[model samples]
Target: MTITPQWKDELRARITLSSVIMRTDKLTKAGREWKGCCPFHDEKTPSFYVNDQKQFYHCFGCGAHGDVISWMTEQRGLSFIDAIKELAAEAGMEVPAPDPVAAKRAEKRAELIDVTTEAQDWFVEQLRGSAGREALAYLNRRGLKPETLREFGFGYSPESKQALPTALPRFEDHMLVEAGMRIRTDDGTTYDRFRGRVMLPIQDARGRVIAFGGRILENRDGVAKYLNSPDTPLFDKGRTLYNLHRASPASRQTGRVVVVEGYMDVVALAQAGIKDAVAPLGTALTEMQLEMLWRMVEVPVLCFDGDAAGQRAAMRAISRALPMLAPMRSLSIVRLPSGMDPDDLINDRGVGAMEKLLAEPKSLLDTLWEFERDAMPLESPEAKAGLKKRLMEHVDTIGDPDIQSLYRRDLLDRFSAFAYPPRQQAKRGPWRGPAAAPKTLSNGARSTLQKSMSGGQRSDLLGAVIAGLVRHPGEISRHSEALIELARHDQSAAPAIESLIELAETLDSRIQTAISAEQGFPAPPVDNRYAFLREGTPPGEAREELAEAVSLLAHKPALEAAMAATIARFDEDPEGSFAEQARLRQQLMTVDERLKAFGRKKAGSDTARDENSVSSDS
Candidate 1:
């Protein structure tokens, strides 16, 4: 039966390797993996290990390594088709019926791989021969050791257009063309695709040479400095990373992977003993490559040049990664010094600098904020608003709801600090005057003041508004100045209110919302006085209500203090104090009327809006 790559991948994903291995060998749990005696070789101690997370198994005794299907084929002595059939049966999947076209395509793919492998060998021979002296010298000048060259399968493609085809005559012209080693013009003439360049083989996760990337030895007008093979049956530059096969094992050991911009950077880092470094094959990091990176490590550090292009590349990777982000799976970013790539950094500052940079790579959130924050000038309010919009837009791309909420809160908090920084307090001199005497109150005034200070209705109203602010934490920044002033004056409710404001400043918006929900502030009073405190209120409306609440809360205390002052003046200036007291009473009445009107308007409108929403849904 002909099986497409998609079907094969689905089969592999469905079958747990440990379950299959455990049929014959007893496997013990080992951290995130399982271990057993070597299945390929007779060993007294357990050396075979299986990682279900990565879906692969390796035996330390005889260097045996493969996935579920491979285990069946190699250990059970089944052919590829029989092994896949068995696994598919066990996985409860139907094997695709044989298709002549798909079988031909599969065969063609194998042929293409063979052609590319042959071309790779030819390129390697050319690199060691007399014709490749300049290329060898170039590699030597770049400080590549001989062992590194051989290990990476570094080779050279001669400048002559026919060098590759001529050297590998065993591969038909069409086969070489399909392999991406030869370019066939529309007129039917064919020439070498990669010529006069230092060749680096781009491999699959299984270490098969799927494609080649070539860097020109000499500068030439209108020529790209580096060229990579066009997409072919065996190669997809976007889906492949330069050194993943070698880096995967290294990543397993270090629990980290460093992604660079190009193959040369990967080579440089590997030479410096950082073996877990990989790079995109002449393209930006794609979603597929990010998935591959995540499979190796929870968070892969993206190391890019510190220049503008590198920053732009990092942002591109971040954009691709955002939608794919999970709870612990994300990216860290390291920016090299300006005008330096990994190789240059390693050469100039030594490996320690690169290692240190990797060790302290910035979190994806930090890199994202820094990038968007400095993407353009924020000298104007409009620019700052633009930054906030861009940040929220990026955060919106995250598919995970929890991660999205956290990112939104984080970015918005950073934006709040940037756009509305806390006001610096003015320095004060020591007090030098005697304190003012307390004022005596009439029975009516004392009764009114005592009721207002009772901390029942008034405190509940204040708490509801504070809870509303917590629910709509983004509104806190707009009222930050007012909150600080309230914190200074309202000593009775200051601590609780101040704590909420501080939390709003730092905590994720979702967390603040969760806290408000848990606080169970009583539902809007029977009169619906605090309409904004209703669940699901719009942010704009909630902010307006919060502003009114703050004003009322602050005004009551200010009015009380003014009344005391007026009563104090009664002993000295009775006529003036009487007029001032009457004006203060009228002002307090106006505030009361405004509050009542606000509550009435919100209650009516909120009810209407809810009805409309229900009607629309219906």
Candidate 2:
């Protein structure tokens, strides 16, 4: 049975090269390629590289080069047919049965490719000829260099309907029409499909011309601004990106791929020295196109036009990508400023400005939340509920359970914070009422109150907890519920604790590193009980001690509140209040014992380590 080239291409596209090679050779990510010691030859320094975007691996040391199938044949010593069978099984593809008609169709597809390639050559010649003067001037006005124009194969199509037929008189008219180079009317009349426009050749993965995209040299009253080849044997607009042939290799170098709105945007960015950019062909991004982008880079940046139409386009792409999202595979979006595009921004600012925007593209979830949050007025409860409903609807489209749950949780957290913000404490003015005579307090209650007050006044346990939180702000989420409980019970320390948690919510990796390096909080007290706050503490040990400290701090307020409540009931039920007070006293003692145990454990560990060091020295 003869395996068609199309089937092999499908199999290769389905299987990631690195995944197959990594089974034998341990590869580490080095930018857009995976590098490791050459499996074919022994080497101390790593030189073997595998590129998923190109679906091939090469070794600088041994000069071994091949794709997944070739790798299997060379490494595993499997026959070519055997390798194909194995890969076919893995990719869930069935080998096509031998058929004469299938063979004939494949041959016809090749003829169509030849027709498009020939048409592309003719168009390029026209651009360089006298007929293309206006198109050439238009390109020059757009700031395209001679090399850029040649590199992208920019061309021009004449306005005459029979120009292609006159140029390629040997080819039948039906073949030109089939290749999307000519259009046939209902009355059996044929005309050039893309006429009197600046042309762009859209190629496949192997750099074979499959279709053409045309932009009018000048905006006319009734003419469409852009025109693309309709669905043909070789080109499906939804399944193909505008510049994948060039951008795929460029993406391997930059470790990123960018999606723009149109071919013009792609050209503008390329001219600005940003070569790893592509665009959908006169339509919103589709699943197949997104997958193609992902095959090049883990997270492709979608830089849309900054206008309202661009925003709507961004949302449409986001909606299409959400359901197909996987763990490390997702998209980032760059929202250009209002009334600006890549060309406009690059002209106004410089390449650096465009780079900065691309570098900080918003995450898929972030763009979703921002779009929905400001989609409409959220002033009323009904509007807020509507926002929440819309968010969930988007979340529900996610196919991955883990990703869906995470997006749901993250969106709800943002919604809660937005809808029900923390209530602010009212400021107090001077005392208004006359002072009343102070009542005598029991010795135990007074002592407990003094201790709580002293705990608040001095930077002891509370300060250490705050410092620990600053040191490891990421742990705030782990202890958020406890922190909220602590805030409700202890008003004096509540503000600082709540503020720290709030900061943690917004803290990303860069901000967290800055806070840690700057010593954002005051140094904790030198008390041995606060040893976790000392420098050089291991994260695990510090987190354990911090957890204990938080527990004690949280417990103190609850114990004090219970004891005060029991004391207040003494006038109504003397015997019962006395019993309750005794029980509360026992609980307080237990808390104190636990706090002391923490100090003892730390001191004992330090002593043991010191003795071990002394023994080692001796």
Candidate 3:
């Protein structure tokens, strides 16, 4: 369930902040508060303080601060809900479960558990009894070892329609139907839903037999081969994985999870000793399923069958998962050999071959490119145009703007590399140098540029950036929009920004040439902070640094503006605002560090470091 501000407030109110901190850290009474060495960072003396009265903790040494939820997510590395659940348990409070009807369904689901558990035991008994002889043989012929079968709790359902209803006489017919084991016809007739199949229990994260999947042992032309429990109080196939109960823990150690197309594929990988594999239950991966995968590992490997259906399934997952994509969280696809599934490959070439394939799966971008590139022949302009259109269509589905832009660039680059043949570079005419433009600016021009570069919080960066752009007039047009934004937001930098724009297009270079190199210009930054300002720097490096600097100048004002807006929202949405504020601060901090990038580059050299903080000079 979504965490609301009121719920967060209640959660914080229920738990004594100091007690939670004291569970893992040592704290001593310090007036109304408790103090200890910061758990977030190392220190000999206590700098971290916890106030149960205020329901927050703060570390003075490293600027770490947050309440109970933050402590779990930030310090302990638990996910947000995981943190809340743990705290809710400790405080004797019930956390709102992820399911919307969880509170109402909780009791019903618990009872349904017994039905599934009973069904599971009966199925196992039948598997080992006379009724399961054919199913057991099928399992054997499929190369399933006795131990593997037991490990995954493989069982069988008898062909008789009254098999389950009669076997579990204690459970009512309606209970079995509701638990997804019995089908009720409109005419009041009821029968088994999974007749004549081998049964494998579908479990929750805690290993409860919440649902079941069955594979048909008999081959009837009109019959389906595989079946899963319908959506019930205890299970939702779209939100559940076949082997998550076992795979989640294993994936922690492996730092990876392999998602295959079927439960048998998951079992096959497990039998081969690759225990961190799971599968969606007879469907394409859903958004909820992808989120579940992300919680286990940053990037899960998707291994689908080698047939056209398999590739199509992989693409369906990609399309569904694109919008949910976040930084560092996406899928890697393993395309099996033609006509081979994971089980077939492991049996044919060995686990090492499967492992090799897993070890070098195609990246999401690579998979998308290859699939579309091969979808139709790119032999004509229209065909190739469709390829480009499709690539962007996939990219446009991504939610994060930064990730979206990056995907667009990378995919388009790939498209250009693939669809268009490269040509030899045309020879250029010999270059001729013009005499350095007159080292004198007209009085009217000098006054305007000087006034524009006068002052602001970003004055130092803006002034310096404008100077760099003038020196490299050829580069100004490239970053014109951002420079215009900088001028719009920081009025003090407007005149210099306008002149730089003109210098790139309409105005003569001599005007800027004199202003930058001669006297009476915006005074040169004392440190010559940017690469563009440094003598003997590479032209490419200088241009790149100037672009980054201008971007920072354009964005710094907007970033601070957002932070202020977050602060303004604090009273209305403290939890949300605080979380948003932290994230925005992180972004601002990144920009701050980037502002000092030239300094970092100089750290490797035998010179003074670039100490360029966003200057407040006027």
Q: What is the C-alpha lDDT profile of model 2 across 195-236, one tens digit per residue?
A: 899999998865789999999988999999999999998999
TM-score of each: 0.59, 0.61, 0.65
Each candidate: RMSD: 22.6, 18.5, 8.1
For candidate 1, write residues 1-618 as lDDT tens digits. 546667777988998889988997799999999998875445699988999989999877555566786666445534466676788889899988768887788888888888788888888998999979999999999999999999999999888998876687787888888888888889999998898999988888668888999999989999999999999988888788888879876775676889999889999999999999999977889988887676556689999998999999999999999999864468999999999999999999999999999999999999999989888999999999899999999998999775686688668879998899989989644322214432322344323322332343347566666656655555666566556656566776665555545545444333323232222222122223454666666666766777778767666566667767887875465334544554454345445656667667767867987898999999
By summed lDDT, the worst window of 10 consecutive residues in model 3 runs over 609-618
Candidate 3 regions with alpha-carbon error over 4 angstroms: 1-104, 140-147, 218-220, 252-254, 295-298, 326-329, 348-356, 396-402, 429-618
TM-score preference between candidates 1 and 3, better one: 3
Clash pairs (backbone) in predicted model 3: 1-98, 599-610
Misplaced by over 4 Å in model 2 are: 1-44, 47-98, 425-618
- The ten-residue window of minimal lDDT in model 2 covers 510-519
| C-alpha lDDT (0 to 100) for residue 216 of candidate 1 | 94
Candidate lDDT values, in order: 0.75, 0.78, 0.78
